[model samples]
Target: MGWVACWFIPAILQVVRKHLCLRHDLRGFDGGPSACSRKGCVSLSSCSEAVSMSKVLPAADTLPTVGKKLLKGRRYGLIAHGASITSRGKLILEFLEDAGIEPPQVIFTPEHGLFGEYAYMEPVPSDEKGWRGVPIISLYGSSFESLAPPQRTLSNLDCLVFDLQDIGARYYTYLATMAISMEACARAGVQFVVLDRPNPIGLSDIEGNIPKPYLRSFVSYLDVPNRHGLTAGEVARFFAYKRGLDLDLLVVECAGLVRPMQLPDTSLPFCPPSPNINDFECALLYPGLCLLEGTNLSEGRGTTTPFKVFGAPFIEDPFAFCARLNEFGLEGVAFKPLFFVPKYDKWAGKRCGGVQAVVLDRRKIKPLLVGLCIVWTAMHIYREGFQWRREPYEFEERWLACDLLFGDETIKTLIEMATSPFEVYEYMNAQSKSFVEESRDFFIYPDSV
Candidate 1:
C-alpha cells in the first residue's frame, strides 16, 4: 500500500505540473506521460526541480551591471524613492556613486518622500542638504502646480531619469509623477530615461476602465485600466507615444523578466513603495481596495494592515455582509467579517465593521472586479448610510472621489442604479480586454518568451 501511494503521488504531481505549465504558458516543459516503475519511482525532489526553472529576475537587479553605461557623462535628474534599490539591497544612488558616476545633480521624490516614511499625501519639501548633498525636490505637493517640476529645474539637466517601483494600480501616483516629469522633460528638451522595474501585479492582467477626459486628474492622467499591467519603462514609452511627446526617451529594460510574473515570483527584495503598501498581498489588493478612499468607509488606512481590510462605523452586520459577498463566488479571494478600530484616517478612533479580503490565489483574483463587487455589496447593505466621499481626492476638488478613483462616472451611476455586480464585472472585463490589446504595442516584454 505504501509503495502504491508513493508511486501515485509522483505521477499526480507530474500531472499537476503539466496542467499548471500549460495554463501559465511556461515554456521548456513538455506535458508528456512520465515513466514510473514499482522498484524506483520519481521522487518529490525531482518534481520540485521541474517547477523552479521558470522564475525570472527583475530589471532592478541587472541595472547596475548592464545599465550603468547609459548614465555615463550625463548630468541627470532622478525621480526615485526608497524602493529604488538594487536586488542586492544597495540604494540606486549609492550604486551610481560606486560605479564612479556622479550622483544626480537633482533628485525628485514621489508621494511618500525619499525615505518612504511619510504618510500618504503628506507634503514633502525640496531639500538642498539631503541625500549626499544632492538637491532633492518633491514632485508631490499640495496642488497640481507642485506635481510637475518647474521648467528651470529640468532645463539645466541633460537627462531626466525615472526609477520608481510601481504597484501596477492606476491610483498609485508614481506613474502620474513619471508622466508629468516626462512631459516636463519634453518641454525642456531634456532626455528622458526609465530604469525599468517589474509590475508587482504582473504584466498580463489589466483591469478596469480608463478615466474620462474631464475626470482626469493626477491619478488618472493616462487613459489606461485601473490595473495597467505594464512595467514602469513600458508605461513611460506608452505615455510618450500616446501623447506624442517629441522627447529623447530611453528605457533601460530589465533582463530575464517575462509576463505573468508578479513581484513575489521574482527573487528581488520587496521594498514598500508607500506607508500602507507593505507587502505583495497589499499590492495585489490595492487596485480594488484603494477605491475605498473615495467612500466614507475606512479602507483600513489607520490600521497596521491597510488595503487588506476595510470597514466603516455604519457597517453594523459584518458577518452578514461577508456571507453575502461569499455568495457572489468571486474568484481567487474569500471575505471574512472583521471589526477594527482605526487610529487615523476615516472614522478615526471609531470601531468599524467590514470584511477582510483573503487572497486564495493571486492568479485568479481580479482585483478591480472584486473591488467593484465589494463597493456594490456595501452600498446595497448600507443604503443611505453608504456615501461617496465629497472631499477633494488626489488634488481634484471638482470631481467626486469615486469618479476620480474609477476614472469614469458611469461605474458610480451603475452601482447607484442597483445594477448587479456581475453585470458591472462583465462590462469591465470587456473594457480591460480591449485595453490590453490596444496597449500591446507598448509592451517591452512579450506575453511569451
Candidate 2:
C-alpha cells in the first residue's frame, strides 16, 4: 500500500496547504475534526486561540493491572526490554511480588540489552544478574536470531507477558520480537498477554510505502502500515486473530487513552528503545532518517546526539545549501543546518555536516518519508560521497541496507529516478492505506477512530 492523496483531500482536505490545519466536514467546512481523532485528525477551530482541552487519555491509574491478574496464581517468563518495560507502565518484579507472584521464572530480552544499556544492533543475551536475580535470556543468539523461540525455552513456562512502548516505526525491532514471541507462544500452547500502550505516532496519521512481502524482516513481521496506528497489545491481538492462531492470547487494555493523544500528555516515560535513540525526537525522526545508518556517511552515530542529527567528514554540505533539502518542501518538520563531530559510532571525531530536525508537529511528522528523501537526495547531491554500506544487516547479505530499511528496492529505484518527494510520499501513503484496510480484522479499537 502507498500514500493516496486522491482520497485524502476529497474527504478531509482542510486548509488548502496550511500548516496546523484541521478540517471538520459536519461543522460547515470549519476545521472542527469530523475525521478520526485518534488518527491525528484533531479538532481545531484555528491554529491560534487555543483552549485547554480534555486530556486525550482515560487515566492509567483507573485501569485494572493486567500483570497482577496474570501473575495471580503462577510464576511465568517475562520478556521485556528497557523501553518495552518503562517506569510508566513497566512490569517490575515488585509489582509481581505485590500481586503475590512467587517469582518470575525467567526474562527474555530482544536485540538491546535487558536494561537498554547496550548500543544499537548489539545482541543482548541471558544474564544471571537480570532484574531480581531472574536470568535474562538473549533471543538474538547467533542460532536464535530468527523471530522464534527454541522449544526448550518454553518447556517450563505456562504463560508469557510482553509490555513494550513502541514508536510505531517499521525498523524498530521491538514489535518484531513481540511477533516472534507471540508465534512461539502460539506454537507452544503458552498463554501470552500484551499490555497495551499508546502509539506515540498517532494511528490515524500514517506514511511510508508498504513493503512488499519479499521485503520482510524481523523489523517487519507482518504487512502493516509503516506508521501503524495501534498499540503493542492491539498489534498482538490483531496478529493472533487475523492469522487464525487460536492461542490463549489476552491484551491488558490501556485505560483512558484516546486517539491522537500527543506523546507528552500520555504520562508515559520516554525510554529509548535502543542506546542511540536517547530522546523522543530521535524516535520521531527515525521513520524517515534511519536509513543513513546503512549508508557509508555517518548519520551521527557514536555521539551524544544520534538519529536526531547526522554528519560526515566528507563532501561538505553542513549548511545543506548545496543539497537544497528544504527545497523539497517537506511538511511538519523544520530543518536547521548544523555540524558536529561524533564521539564514537560511524564517523567518530570527524566534523560531518547535517541538520537537526526541529519537529514542529510530531503528529504530522512522517519520518519514513523524510528518511527516504534524504537517502535519495544525498545519494545524488553528494555523488561520490554516498555509498551503501554493502555490509550484511541483521546477518543477511542478499538484501542491501537500503532494501532492509525501506522494505523494498523499488523505493530505492524510484528515488534514483529523481522522483519528487511529494510523489514519493503519496506512493508510500497509498501502500500504507492498503495495509490499514487489509489489517481491519485485527483492529481491536473502534473502526472509525
Candidate 3:
C-alpha cells in the first residue's frame, strides 16, 4: 500500500503541476497565465510579456532614471544590503555616481552585513571607510538599540533610502530593520524612501498567523503572518500607516517584477540575501524551516543545502520519517531520507539522519505548514531526545524560542496536545487571510503584482 501510494502521489502531483501551468524547473516556479507548450511546460522567457505588464521597477532603477529630481541636493542616507542593486546589474552606489548624485553620507546595513557574507547572528561592524568610501553603519549590531540609527546620524541626512531584498518572511529581520529605521526617521523628521525590490517569493502568497503582541522581538516586530507577501516598500507604507507616524514615506516601486514570478523566472541575477538563502528554493523553504532554529535539530545550516534539508544526530530512521511525512500529501514537495555531517552550527562534525525536502511544485507548497509538520513529527517520533532549545534566542532570554518563532504560545500548546499539522495550518490560514484583507489599504501594488 505504501509503494502504491508513493507512485500515485507523484502521478497526481504531475497532473496538478500541468493543470497549474507550472514549468518543470525546480530552481523557481513562475505562475503567470502563459500557455503551456506541448510537453505541458512553459519556458521562463515565454512569460516575459506578463512580467513586463506587471511594471515591477526596483526603487534603485527608478531613482536615477525616472525619479532623478528627488535625489538632487538631498544628502540621503541609504539603508541597504548587498542585494540592493539596479536591475541593469550595477550596484546602487555605482548607479548613483553615474546619475551625478552625491554619494550617500551614511550607509546602514542589516543582519547579514553589507557584503552578505556573515553567518547568522554574527555582529557586523560599522565601516568607517564604507562601501565606495561613504561612512557605513551596521543596523544589526550587538544590541537591540543598535538596530536603529542614532538621532545624530539621521540629523545629518535629508532623506533615508532603504533597499533590501525581503524573502517574504516576518522573521527574516530585514523588515524589522526597515521598521526601526522608519520610526527613527519619523522622530528625526527625515524622509524615508524605500527603493523596493521583488519579495523573491513574490506577492499574493501570505501565510502564517500574526505574532502575538507580547512575543514580539526583533525577529517578529510586526503582527503580520510569517509569510507576509508585500514588498519591502509596501511594508514601509504599512508600517507608516499602522503606526500613524507623521513622516514622509515614499516607495520607489519595482518594474517588470510580478507576484506570480519568483526570482529564478525573472532575468535578474540571484544574489544570496543572506549566507544560507543561496537560491530561490532556499528562500521558499525558509518561511518554515527557519523554525528549526528554536530546536536542537540542524536545519542544514553547515551543509550546502541549508533549509532544503534538516536533521539531528538522534533521528534514528530517516526513511521512516520521510514515509510518515509523505502520508500528509503536502503539495509541491516530497521528502527523501538524508544523512549528513555539518562542519558548523547545531550538531557540528557529527553524523545525523534527516530528510531532504525536495520541491516538486513551488506553486503548491505551503512552507509554513510543512515546517510545522516537520517539527511536530520530530517531537512525536523522538519523544525523549527531541527538546526545544532554552538558550537565549534573538536576545530573548526568558521566553521559549519556539513561541517567539511561531508567534504565539498556543502553537506550543497545540503541539503538546498532539494536534495534527493540518489543524494548526487551518488556524494560521484563517488569521492570515483576514490580515491580507485588512492590509489591502496599505498595498502599493493593489493589483496582481
lDDT score, candidate 2 = 0.62
The residue-by-residue lDDT of candidate 3 on 1-449, one tens digit each, is 35764564344333321111111121223323321121212122233432453334465766554446777878888887778776666778788888777788999999889888788888889989987688889998888888999999899889998888889899999999999999999999998877778888877677788887888898889868888887787687777777899888776655555556677666677778899999999999999999999899899999999999999989878999889899989889999998999989999999999999999998789898889889889998898879998888877886888888888866665565444666566665665655766666554442332
Q: Write the per-residue lDDT of candidate 2 for residues 1-449, one digit (tens) a residue.
A: 24543444333323222222121112122212322132311122121211122233221221124344446666578776666543245345454565455666888877766777766666655677777687777877654354565667787788887766677777777887888888888888888866566677655555665667776776656556566666776577667665688688766544435445646765666667677778878877877777786788677677677777765676475676334767766677877787788888777777777777678877666677677667777777777787887887775678888787777666555565534545555555655544555554444343222
- Candidate 2: residue 112 lDDT (0-100): 66
Error of 1 at 290 (Å): 0.8
Score each candidate by Cα lDDT: 0.77, 0.62, 0.77
Model 1, which residues run further than 4 Å from truth?
Answer: 1-55, 62-66
Off by over 4 Å in 3: 1-56, 446-449
TM-score for each model: 0.86, 0.82, 0.86
Candidate 3, which ten residues in sequence have the lowest lDDT sum?
Answer: 17-26
Name the regions of candidate 2 deviating beyond 4 angstroms: 1-66, 84-91, 143-147, 321-323, 446-449
Candidate 1, residues 279-366: lDDT per residue as tens digits?
9999999999998888898889989889999888888889998998999887899999999999998999998998899999999988
